[model samples]
Target: MLLAHDDEGSGPAVVLLHAGVADRRMWDAITPALAHTFRVIRPDLRGFGETPMPAEEYADADDVDALLASLGVTDAAVVGSSFGGRVAMELAMLHPARVSSLVLLCAAYRGLEPTESVRTFGAEEDRLLEAGDVGGAVDLNVRTFLGPEAGVAARELLTQMQRRAFDVQIAADQAVPGPAPRRVEVDPTAIAVPTLTVSGAHDLDHFRSVARHLAEQIPGAEHVELEWAGHLPAMERPDAVLALLLDVLRDDPTVHAP
Candidate 1:
């Protein structure tokens, strides 16, 4: 099924894949600017926003490919945040012809052993959900994902997005019970596109490690660590992230200083 998405502007295509705790709306702060220079496509992945959870087996990479195909886009630069970053890599590896470049923001890597902090966060989130404390779960995510640089508005926005995602996912779980979908681990060494992995110093060690691993494994991949960010730097400091994105997306070797 084609994912629900917003396609704006008219230039080279650029797709923004959101984090697990967020929907396409997470890109709202910078989409307008990006739209002026490129065709920006932001999709609500299944079980996250307007898209419903799949009733049958499906891969998110395939879903994204389908969405791009429907838009007549043969290839595009892709940016993914957090869990979205994993999906971005999957797309590049599985559908190499579809991706022109990749930018991963505190991305999650499949098969990476979770750090103690990450495990603790996951367990608490599960406990909250199992206890029917959806609000608490949302709060947990806001606290865990947002950095010190994040302002009140960012925190509130994350709270709303996380709450919405939980509502959609929880309702879907009640309607369809099954094991988690299988994921195909990406072979980073085979990725040939210009790739950049951005990590936040304040993020969990697991994600930082994943960023480094991707940079090392993916030939020609560049890694940048943001000193003032957490797991979700885009939300924490949209303008700064936007500037960074503009520099990289322009594909000017001299523009990307950091």
Candidate 2:
């Protein structure tokens, strides 16, 4: 199915996939900036934002590829944050010809084992959700994902986005039956496109490790760590991340600086 998306601008396609904690709106700060130079496509993946959860089993990577195909786009730069980054990698792996390049921001890798901090965070999130304290869960997410750099506005926006996500996902869980969506294993070494893996120093060790692994495994993939960022750098510092994205897209993708 074609996931709900916003398509703007008139140049090479640049798809912005948001973090798991956020929806397409997560790119609200940088979309307009990037759209000035590229065909910016931002999709609200299933069960997020404008896209409702699917009743049938489906893969997010397939949904994204289909969305692009419907838009008449064959290849484009794919940028993803957190879980969205994992889907971006899957897209590049499954639909190799459709992705010109990849930019992973605190990307989630299926191969890595969760760190202790990550496990604890998950447990707490689960407990809160099980107790039906969605507000608590949302607060937990904001605290964990956003860093010291996040302003009040950004934090508020994240709270809204994440809460909406939980509401949609929870409603779907009650209605939809049978297992969750499955992910395809991504082999970083097989990804041939120019790739950039970004990690935040303040992020959990699990994500940092994933970033390093991607950079090392994916040929020519450049890894950059943001000293001031947490998991959602795009939301934390849109200007800085936007500049980094433009630089990577306009110049040599393999070359970058933090």
Give residue 218's lDDT in candidate 1 (0 to 100): 95
**Residue 157 lDDT (model 2):** 94
Computed on alpha carbons, the lDDT of every model, listed in order, comes to 0.90, 0.93
RMSD of each: 1.3, 1.3
Clashing residue pairs for model 2: none
- After superposition, the stretches of candidate 2 with alpha carbons farther than 4 Å from their true spots are 176-179, 252-255
Against the true structure, what is each candidate's TM-score?
0.96, 0.97
In candidate 1, which residue ranges exceed 4 Å CA deviation? 177-180
Q: After aligning candidate 1 to the native by TM-score, how far in Å is the CA of 112 from where it should be?
A: 1.6
> What would the per-residue lDDT of candidate 2 be over residues 52-140, giving only the tens digit for each residue?
88678788889999999999999999999999999999999889999999999999997888999999999999999999999999999
- The local lDDT score (0 to 100) that residue 21 gets in candidate 2 is 94
